[model samples]
Target: MAVTYLMLARLPEGGLGAFDAYESAVLPLLAEYGGRLERRLRTLDDRVEAHLISFPNSEDLAAYRADPRRSAAAPLLESSGAAVELLAVRDI
Candidate 1:
């Protein structure tokens, strides 16, 4: 079954630049894994960032997570100290 993910991140202190870099690096990788972004949003008040993505299946999601480029960009998340919450769902 197809899967959907709601990725919520707590932006880092100097969040914009790092977040921007993270976005640039990761977004395209999703497509390679048979996934696409459905919606992306961020709130000014809490600076909570969210992205809604759909994938063909769990395997696609796993591959996306394992992508080398994505793994390299992983450091941006670490240095920025962003908290992340990933929620996965699917149509009933």
Candidate 2:
């Protein structure tokens, strides 16, 4: 299995709204491509949010990353003013 962690920093101004839409709309679409959200959290101290997504393997992760739904949601996320930092890990 493989896991991808996304640390998201919402853009100033409309961050919360954007993050909400992303969680409601975009994250669900990832499941259709074999991705599952393992964890999600909002950090008060750092003023950022984080998501941990898992896939069966690298191929599945790739599929999720390349999915049209993900692509479609990009603009909405951008409009909402959000940026993501991604980290990937492979299970032993």
Best-performing candidate as measured by TM-score? 1
lDDT of 2: 0.70
Question: Per-residue CA lDDT of candidate 1, range 1-92, in tens?
Answer: 88899999987567767877888888988888899999999887646889889999989999899989988999877776788999996656
| RMSD from true fold, candidate 1 | 1.6
lDDT against the true structure, per candidate, is 0.85, 0.70
Q: Which stretches of candidate 1 lie over 4 Å from their true place?
A: 90-92
lDDT by residue (4-32, candidate 2, tens digit) is 65555645555677667766777777777
Q: Give me the runs in candidate 2 sitting further than 4 Å from their true place.
A: 4-6, 90-92
Alpha-carbon RMSD, each predicted model: 1.6, 2.6
* Clash totals, every prediction: 0, 0
Q: All candidates' TM-scores?
A: 0.89, 0.76
